[model samples]
Target: MRAGRLRGTLGSADRPASALGFRRVLAVFGALVLLVGAIAAFALTDQVWLGVLLGAAFVAACVNVYWVSRRLQHERPNR
Candidate 1:
């Protein structure tokens, strides 16, 4: 059986939640911008590959942001 408790707090809890929330929001905004750019690239340019790449990147970023948010929410404070 594990006998010792975890020693430190989650780093996200150490800072104000608003800061983390702001960063999360910023990440979402950036992802949306990428999506818009992808759409524009698909419509306005001959490079269909560029649109595909940007769309993939946007999807990856959205997944990443969701992952971070879930991780932070599930963490418990060491008190």
Candidate 2:
């Protein structure tokens, strides 16, 4: 167990995640927020087609957020 932990730490020493993953996470969060706003605007305007479109985009952004989170988690060290 110690050896495994050591290896994990060593492998991640030079590939720190703080800066590298932050931008992607921030971007995904921003997109998600924008999608939510668009969804609300479309709903309020009574534009069914645009609302549906925005909903789809919102869903896609949600999935992307999940994927990016998972990827970043994997990139980080266990410790």
Question: What are the RMSDs of all candidates, in order?
Answer: 5.4, 5.1
What local distance difference test score does each model get? 0.77, 0.68
| Candidate 1 residue spans exceeding 4 A from truth | 1-18, 75-79
Cα lDDT for residue 15, candidate 1? 35
lDDT of 1 by residue, 5-48 (tens): 54444454443243555667877888999999999999999999
Q: Which residue window of length 10 is worst by lDDT in model 1?
A: 9-18
Q: How much RMSD separates candidate 2 from the native structure?
A: 5.1
- Candidate with best TM-score: 1
Clash totals in order: 0, 0
